[model samples]
Target: MTRSELIAQIKQKKSFLCVGLDTDLTKIPEHLLDEEDPIFTFNKAIIEATSDLCVAYKPNIAFYECYGLKGWESLQRTATILPKDCFSIADAKRGDIGNTSKMYAKAFFDPQVSGFDFDSITIAPYMGKDSVTPFFEFKDKWAIVLALTSNEGSADFQNIENAEGVQLFEQVLEKVNSWGSIENTMYVVGATRGEAFLKIREHAPDHFLLVPGVGAQGGSLSDVCQYGMNKDCGLLVNSTRNIIYASKGTDFAEQARIEAQKLQKEMQIELEKAGIC
Candidate 1:
């Protein structure tokens, strides 16, 4: 999807919620195990239940890759089942040298290469421009660079400052923005880092942000929208464990729907408050 298409979806849905398909086979209801592919079964239910309530779905690749071939199959099935209008992302956090990165790009962006053609893929910027530039080689696809993550370990490197006193992440946002326009580039800013949002926005006010750390992670939806929303409502706030695994029983999908609805309703209010509605 192009940037304008994403912005249009946000407007039409009155939401910026991005549901995370971090599907773990061990965590899904045991009943689903009867199916040939329990992971895909769980994901299909979650997508069907929450599709109308949110604008995007992100499948974290590690969850599938750990399980080997079957896990990968589930990831492909999940991607195929997602709503067409809703944005899709492969949370692979992939980056390598130019040539290698090109293969990773083909894996996620090429429908023929990856089985699942995602609208975007999460990327790591620590390797510099060659690592990221390859992903943008595809048409209408996106590269969501990791700027400030929610993990506790982020403080180890992202927070370190240089002589100019600029945090490493801030420097990343500044430098990486040069490689792609706001139309194709995005930054991953954890919702837990709500305090850093204002400063983060100061560097790239117009680009979209893929925000995780809400719900089970305890990142406040209200606080995230208050500081991170731009004129185009540039945020894809995500919730994973909280929504998908809300219940482990037969009514799991229903429970997931309720959880997704709560977040969507909260987002509706935030949009109105920001006068973006």
Candidate 2:
């Protein structure tokens, strides 16, 4: 999706919500296990329930990779069923040597090769430009680079400062921006880093941010919008556990819709407040 198309979806839905499909087999409803493919079954229902309430869907690659072949089959089915109007993301934090990175890009962006054509994929930029640039080679696809993450150990490296006093993440923002345009590049900014958005905006005022760590992670929605929102409502706040795992019964999909609706309502208010809708 282009930037204009994405912005249009945000306005049309009155939301910038991105639902994470970190679907775990063990966590799904017990009844679903009886199905031929429980993971895709659960994902299909969840998508049917919440597609209108969200602008994007993110499937964390590890969740399926752990199951081997069956897991991969489930991911393929999930990818195929994703709503066309909603942006799809392969939440695979892949980054390696240039050649390997190209393969990774083909795996996600080349539908004929891997049966998965995501609108974007999460990338680890520690390997620098060559490792991260391959994904951008695919037209209209995005490279969502890891920057200020929400994990406890993120401070160990991302927060380290250089001799010039610029933090590692700050430098990452500056360097990565040069590799791609705002239309195709985005940063993974944890919602937990609320006030840090003020600093991030200085280096990336117009770029979109794929924000995680909200809902179950306890990050404040208001704080993220207050500091991070741009005129285009440049944010895709993701929630996984709090929505998909809302219940473990037959009403799981219904409950997920309820949870997603709650976030959508909150997002609508933020959009209105910012004059973005």
Provide the RMSD of all predictions against the true structure, rounded to 1 decimal: 0.8, 0.7
The local lDDT score (0 to 100) that residue 2 gets in candidate 2 is 92
Residue runs of model 1 more than 4 Å from their true location after superposition: none
Worst 10 residues of 2 by lDDT: 109-118
lDDT of 2 by residue, 1-277 (tens): 9989999999999999999999999899999999999999999999999999999999999999999999999999999999989998999999999999999999999989877789999999899999998988999999999999988888999999999899999999999999999999999999886999999999999999999999788799999999999999989999999999999999999999999999999999999999988
| TM-score of candidate 2 versus the correct structure, residues matched by position | 0.99
Error of 2 at 66 (Å): 0.4
TM-score of each: 0.98, 0.99
Residue pairs with backbone atoms closer than 3 Å in model 1 (clashes): none
Q: What lDDT tens digits, residue by residue, belong to model 1 across residues 98-140?
A: 9999999999989886676899999999899999999888889
Candidate 1 lDDT: 0.91
